[model samples]
Target: MDPDSVSTDNILLPRNIEIIDSKIVNLSIILFISGYISKVEISKFSHFRELYLLYIPYKFKLLLRGSRDGFTPRKFHESCDNVSNTLTFIKVKGTEEIVGGYNPLRWESSSSWGKTNDSFIFSLKNNDINNAIISDIENSTYALNYYSRNGPRFGNDINIENPNSQNENYNRIFCKKHHYKKKIRDSEEDFSIEDYEVFQIIKC
Candidate 1:
């Protein structure tokens, strides 16, 4: 389906499926056409999308993919720096865990922190959305960290490091509870990632 053609007015639902809310139906169509989410994962992403839409209607556009664009801090900043309202997804290596965060401020290649109350870190359950955990910013002062040597960092809770490392599987990623309300991952140990993606959220 063409993403440009997606709208609440044109979306046709099956007769068997009851339309409870038009916003969710519209969000499902947009998420499906983006191809970043599968049919099974649409519901999970739809809820996340709705939260953003509550303030302003936004469309997610793919900015970077670790496997496709290279998993370096240089590569991440090249495509994502100066872009505001981005959603990042990291697929943990050797596991089904998907951890990510939403940055409402522009990313820069400088050593500084971006403060925002809307930013959040989360872990999406691969099969069940109910088990997913979302951690809101407990300390707004350290909501986001923009470091020249790191990819992305959500407070002191989660960070992607190793700008000097040549190996993609290097143990550079770390997740722990710090400035966030709760931990997204059960373990606070540093881990490698299978792949990661970043999407720019544009107001529609």
Candidate 2:
């Protein structure tokens, strides 16, 4: 072995990836809606799809009505991007915490408001982005998972109101909201960076 020879290790990843202004190839339509990023090879171009990104309404609110197209996950851009076995975060920072659950709304629609082919994209019909599934990450006050909120009451069509008096339902989940008996200091000193990171996610 040559003593002068040096070894190099690539350490620029697995922390947080950033998007430089230059790499904005195809503008992401469902950028916030879809979750992560992955890579794949096809016959020709390095095509991109709804790879990586997952449905965490914290990013959006529970904008849709049901779960992932009937409580199922689909491959957004199959042949082109070919990203599989990827982990998506419903959390998008303020801290490293993430919110988790099968996004109840995303699965209800085609997950797409429209249709698409190779070199382009589109939207699904009735593109109503008014999120019903409010969470602490989005509203930052209250939240309940699909199981917690999924009942006959939640399925009722939204009734928006601006009452003249003090009698109006403040569109919410859990009939009420979480009343914590004690305040948990989020920045607990004994926690390792990664420990607190995972703990922060609201696991549904």
Candidate 3:
């Protein structure tokens, strides 16, 4: 062997894998509601680095009655861009059920809502508050037409303010208002809700 030949063993190489330790994100949606962001427990399965919290006031949530419709508030478009997962957590008013779901898609402001083919909404069923089930993924689009403010105009047949109406009977999760005046069927993807705090899970 020639003494001038360089030894490959002495060559330095870059690391191929960067190990990251799991840590809790300091983001607090509760802060906006209760003026606190820490100690906000979330399901461990919510693997996110950053979270944009949106608090839906109970007064505003009262309008979520009736069928499922797309509902967006004044500042709803503030976080509509980018690819992110929407995690909604609802606390039933008259029951002990704390249920919500995750929509794996970007909230778009386009003509209609743009969604990924892997869209799904899951709920925290009994005996498993942290582990939610994948309710559905067949529909590429879970969120239909979007509407801001009071939603679409309806006839006298529907009483949006009636406490005994289905709207107030079964509190639905925080979602958008639609353009059409029809009942949004509660399927696997469309789960019922009450008072909820929505968060947009984002990666750093």
User: Which candidate leads the pack in TM-score?
Assistant: 1
Candidate 1's TM-score = 0.72
lDDT (Cα, tens digit) per residue for candidate 3, span 107-178: 444435444444333333332433433333343443332322211111111111212332223322332223
**Superposed model 3: Cα runs more than 4 Å off:** 1-72, 79-83, 125-127, 130-132, 141-145, 149-194
lDDT (C-alpha) at residue 177 in model 2: 21
TM-score of 2: 0.17
TM-score, per-candidate, Cα-based: 0.72, 0.17, 0.38
Q: Global lDDT of each model?
A: 0.70, 0.21, 0.32
| TM-score head-to-head 2 vs 3, winner | 3
- Of 2 and 3, which scores higher on lDDT? 3
- Model 2 stretches with alpha carbons more than 4 Å out: 1-32, 36-46, 50-124, 127-136, 145-149, 152-204
lDDT of 1: 0.70
Please give, for residues 90-156, the per-residue lDDT of candidate 1 as tens digits.
8887877778888879999778899998888877655344566778899999999888677878988
Error of 3 at 167 (Å): 17
Backbone N/Cα/C clashes per model: 0, 17, 12
Q: After superposition, how far is residue 83 of candidate 3 from its true place, in Å?
A: 6.4
Q: What shift in Å separates residue 202 of candidate 1 from its native position after superposition?
A: 1.1
